[model samples]
Target: MAIARPVRALGLAAIMMWCFFLWTIFRPGAGIKGPGDSLANLERDPNLDPTGEPEGHLVHTSDAYLPDANPSARINATLLALVRNEELEGMLQSMRDLERTWNHKFNYPWTFFNDVPFTEEFKRKTQAVTKAKCNYELIPKEHWEVPSWINDDLYKESVKILEEHDIQYADKISYHQMCRWNSGLFYKHPALQNTQYYWRVEPKVHFFCDVDYDVFRYMHDNNKTYGFTINLYDAPYSVPSLWPETIKFLAQHSEYLHDNNARDWVTDKLRRPSHNDQASGYSTCHFWSNFEIGDMTFWRSQAYEDYFNHLDRAGGFFYERWGDAPVHSIALGLFEDSSRIHWFRDIGYQHIPFFNCPNSPKCHGCTTGRFTDGEAWLNMEDCRPNWFKYVGMG
Candidate 1:
């Protein structure tokens, strides 16, 4: 079709304008020297915004939204921490040195909990030794003292029983109190209020190799709520055969009573094959509560509080040399679903009564000839048949 002269001229003008605008906006800008401009100029020139931070970057991107990206994350556990209390001069210094690598490298904070006050020299010196924040706290009066509810008579009876059996540290009421406090209240510290993960450290506990990744972070990240070393010393005979009472509580109260965490810990033949899961009504009782990394909320749960209170009311803490380890392990077994109590086969652990090593270099040293059978590690299995089997006869 033939176009009118004025219309054709207008159309040609419109095309030219469109081409000019596209060239200016879509095409790359040229340098003052030539038609080709360097990307460096985009970065150097603030107006150009070469980084394009608003858009995004390939690496080292902003983590403003990440929970662990800043200080607040330490509480929710996007970033987590571990702290140790060092007592006495000898084991204290050695363990402190071992901690330097883990603390300095990870910048994890360490809080030294002691019943006796830390001296001026110790504080100044320890601060200098660790780049991490070092806090010294005197064990509170509430933590150290035996509550009035504790029958002094029962306490002495427990001590006498231990003496007769020759169990070391049985006579030390302070040690018993320490165990109770560690399991019951250590995380209640104001400084740790925000922390979701914690590693309890005694004075001489040592980490041998160079640990690059933050263990607290790993536990928190992977949902490996509880980690520990040194299994054994979890004899049910050690606690009151309170299974009748405890099992009744579980079946009536919690749905996850015999969950995987409970099953694996109490029923696994690898850990406690002969444990009586059925007697405990398939309860999860085979757990070692000490040397553990765990979910803080797990302890804060109503189940734990009730269990601790019930055990306390029963006077188990005073009536027996009730170590917090067994108590804590039992609680984890009973209360948490199998997904919660995690076994760290790689952690090296040692104690009296011995356990089948999951991944301890001390595996060759599992020579603890005394409590050789899996019964050495107490659980529901010791009381019930076919307890260690994952699947029940049901």
Candidate 2:
């Protein structure tokens, strides 16, 4: 009888253990939702007040979740690059980064233009890395050559003086040709004629964030005409006489100025719009052209075409080595409303000695921390800080 009692007690203990195991496996909100429930239960949460709200917050319900809009319904845009055969490797690195970060999802086509034909190796290597369609086209000679109107003697003298001063790319006539092409001729390229928007990429530029959304879609949806990452002042030595000429053109064409233009951002402390001063001068600050995503329509507009024609006739491109940076800046400041211009805050970009690194905590790929902070170059060139203030975004 005593042995039976002990055996029965042992069996009961085993049964109890088995029941507990089954309970753990199938119990309602037992192991699965305990931790999560504690977080979601406002009444039980320590952060909540007596009203079961998180301190000062009220109870609210959100609308039904919505799926993302079809990304394929994006704007007609292409990623455009102008490069030489020697720059193939550097361009490929940028292409790969862009692909992995954003274009892989969007599959936007890439159009590359070069003065010389792309070598077989350049085409094959670049095509292998990307799934999107790629087109390589040669630039027409007329577009890449010095205009016949420019006086050779004056151009040579100017280049000699700039080279003596050790100015950047001063001795290279090809560099000046490149600036001129970018200023007015690039949008006219037959390969780019079909697209309404272009995101310009240069050799060795870095994109250091996962661009989850379609930038082109944002531009199209918001009606943003121009987008830039870095804004800085041009070296005064590079364009001493350029701004005075711009002032001259603006005075002659006062009808073209927008109602709410970014005039204060471009002009010196001396501009008076009433009399339209010819000597108002420039602040020399320009949005760096190397990293631009803009509507091609903006550049192709009559206002921009007329502006380019006026500057071209002035012969500053060859005579003074005028860069396209200030030319585009001053034109956009006058012709477009400030609201049409956009600063892409999420894009992390680098073009030697300067970067527009994103400050968002969500940014994981950025090597530089913030656009305006910890960089010595911004202080050395005082345009970026002023750009923030001019745009009312400080």
Candidate 3:
């Protein structure tokens, strides 16, 4: 029985009306919360006696957390970042949103960095909103400047290509400057220079979980290093031969390796097929270096620096548009190995085309036990170069 246009339209309208009624019931656009949350919140309310005491007062519906004090900051962390002077306000606003949401369930401080002075205004406004203890510092001059080994011709040529194509933000000179900063200087910031472990954060990123345990301390105690939020990029079109060059570099510079655990892990991973396990397979290499927590001394170690410098000298920073992904992945491969890299398999994260929620069906354990299934949460499982065992979530 084919329906006439009038009848069909009315039916759709009725269905849509029903949906709208449900939306009103569910309160759509009330922020990230969904109907399930209302029920959950209701269920939890009776458990919390708000007038009881400090602990009673501690209860809240939101998952966001804030720092308690300096010593408390040392216990757990919520390391945040700032690389550009221009984006300070936007970053602060994002922090404010996170602070507004997370209050004290996660009392972790923030660490801010810049290649220039953190203006007093930036500090004042940020503190007003975040309230959490915040530390601001300038990226030392050495850390901001381009390394001398960068090949001017190749670097310029690459930029010219991106610009000729009018690649997204490719023409923005400041972006390039910041990209360069990320490459050579960020990890070298003075405040973080001596710290054994730290988290790399940026303005405007979201924190949507109740994180009580000190992540850095967890790594420090367990002797794991190198955590990240997203997966590394893998576009062979970007640099076809660059991968081989990286392998060669690792082979030659394997001596200065620091973490025997990491080295063994990555070696085994390197031989494994990409997620698909195809014959002409690509490596299941992750390039999500946007957010990372790693040991300062390890990066500053002679061996690691030697490799970084060697690659920097090779002009990859400019030549191939070398991103932090390849740099971190290669370094992890050569230095720490699989056992050393800790993938925070359950941390909620978003980059593009994906939103990573740990407990969801798509997580570290999603695989038929293969890296291919990908991390629904953060996948720290031992990759093909499986040295780092993805310890089950905390």
* TM-score winner: 2
Instruction: Give lDDT tens digits, candidate 3, residues 1-394.
Output: 8999999999999999999988877673232222232221222211111111111112232233334333343543346575566777667655754454444445456778776787888877777775557888876676656667666666677777756544455444455556656655666665664456666656655554434355665666666667664544344333333455656676887565554433332222333444323212335455366667776666777766776666666664555555666566657665665455655644555433333344433222221222223341124422211222321111
Model 3 CA lDDT for position 347: 54
Question: In model 1, what lDDT does residue 364 have?
Answer: 32
What lDDT is obtained when candidate 2 is compared to the true structure? 0.73
Q: Which stretches of candidate 3 lie over 4 Å from their true place?
A: 1-78, 97-107, 151-153, 162-173, 256-284, 360-394
Scored against the true structure, residue 303 in model 3 reaches a CA lDDT of 68
Error of 2 at 322 (Å): 1.5
The TM-score that candidate 1 achieves is 0.62
Alpha-carbon local distance difference test for all models: 0.51, 0.73, 0.52
Error of 1 at 147 (Å): 1.4
TM-score of each predicted structure versus truth: 0.62, 0.77, 0.63
Better of 2 and 3 by lDDT: 2
Clash number for each model:
13, 0, 35
